[model samples]
Target: MLTLSRRFAAVAFSALALVACGAAGDGAGTSGANPSEANADGELGHVLGQADAPLTIIEYASPTCPACKYFHDTVKPTIEEKYISTGKVKFVFREYPLNEIDVAAYAMARCAGDDKFFDVLDDLFENQEGIRYAAQNGVVKTTLGAIGQRHGIADTATFEACLSNSEIRQALADTYATSEKWGVEGTPTFIIDGVKHNFQGEYTTAEGFSKQIDAKLAELGAQ
Candidate 1:
């Protein structure tokens, strides 16, 4: 049920996702922004959990990725409650925007700042139905802007400003560099304690994810 413009956008996203496979992984050009890249201060990406948590889960996700929306809607609550809230797992979220609209979403998320990143993400995932509808009608940006205002971004001018914010742009580029290092080619790719886990049929449920995480924790003697 995509409108013409939305169909075009979807095609572009798929193309960019394919291109990211090649564009993101050129070694020296990546500039040391892989997952392991961090400062003495702390982890660089949006994060939640105790710093010394037994296990770390790094996720590269797209705002417009349906599978990602599914994960957020269903599986994430369990993982967060059981692992993250319990101080057993640390979660890091990075953007892997696949198109211009996806980039706009990421920019607004960044503009919301580190403190509100997860909140903004929560709202986005919770409202994906509306987002998808808006996308089909060629008003995705307007829809996202409405979402942004609810998060204090306020007004069309500032919302547009978020799209071109240089700092946010750089952070996103760094994620592509990180994806290059890790060979991530899809959404909801989870790196659990350095192991890359894909989000698909087997990983659409919390039980499946917990099985892998529990095993990893035991193996690391952190269980």
Candidate 2:
């Protein structure tokens, strides 16, 4: 059976402690593409693929995580083509911001609304290298503004407003809280059929992921 590692357990505890103490800042304002359908609580996570697929995969990933960028740029397309588009699997992407900047990124993506959330997210991941450089150079806002413009955001003001939206901040915080409850300590954590799977220095490739996913599908008689 899959289990949470001791290190991850400690990390989860620390994250919960931070939430309990309210250390996670509330940043402010909001905007995006037309609002997409949301969960019962109005969280704007984007789900791709068939809703009733026998296999369900939810990924908790940080925008700034290099591993996540790699997964999105490489493995994700394959998964989409093979399983998601084929109606064999349902995939959900959840934001688990690791820092203030990551929270800002999530806010921007969420504000893009459900219709454009995944597109914005894809742009963010594709340009992660440039974004990291901009962040390091203290020009993250300017860089993000340009990115938003490319993705149909109205203007810099709108982009900034979205980044500062309090509601979006709360939604991101709630996502983190849920991740903690699930013992998710790191980015790109995959929850397959309610079982948590950490990267563990392997399974970073499409083939690797498929091996596990296929086994699960076979076990569930969904293949």
Candidate 3:
């Protein structure tokens, strides 16, 4: 079992590479309404809204994070309705797994592939409480296996294989490296147009987030 302290230590070291290499943009343009695109490797994370939306909001989150679940359940819908659907904001979800189980869940979610990624992600967040219970009771494998089946995975073997995939694990680690470079200290961190925004405990609601985003859009002269 991977402990959080050790994981964070790894992040601290990997972030040194980021400093040496310089801060790379999220494969999106810094000026104008440059559309977000999958990297050359075809990894775009899980994205929503148009690629060319004026504002791109990159979120670093873990499926098991309670704050992340609240954002998904309470805040995301409002943002989708007001910004994503309107082409004003493009959203990108990146994995910042906080524990072994979080890594497993993310791997399985990606194993489902891009078409079903967000759907599986939703299910995971929505059922987080049950998953936590299962983990505490030592049935995490069974719990996650059932969740995988519900999302079209064949069986426990397949789920285990997905969880053991080196490639997927590497990709997830790379995402964490990027997040570390960006100074993400916790889950539910947001980066708007390359500017890091720590959750200030003030805007956990849609209205609050909107106020900040709208202000940024106006500053950038984006409609």
Model 3 misplacement above 4 A: 1-44
Candidate 1 lDDT over 104-133, as tens digits, reads 887898898778888888888777668768
Global CA lDDT computed for model 2: 0.68
TM agreement with the true structure for every prediction: 0.82, 0.79, 0.80
Best by TM-score: 1
Candidate 2 total steric clashes: 6
Against the hidden true structure, what lDDT does model 3 obtain? 0.72
In candidate 2, what are the lDDT values of residues 95-196, reduced to their tens digit?
Answer: 887666676777878888878889889888888768767766567777777878877777977887887788877887777776654556666677777666
lDDT of 2 at 52: 83
| Model 1 error, position 102 (Å) | 1.0
Q: Write the per-residue lDDT of candidate 3 for residues 8-116, one digit (tens) a residue.
A: 2223223221121112334322222223332322344679999888888888887777777778888889999989999999898999876777888899999988899
Candidate 2, poorest ten consecutive residues by summed lDDT: 28-37
lDDT of 1 at 151: 90
lDDT of 2 at 180: 58
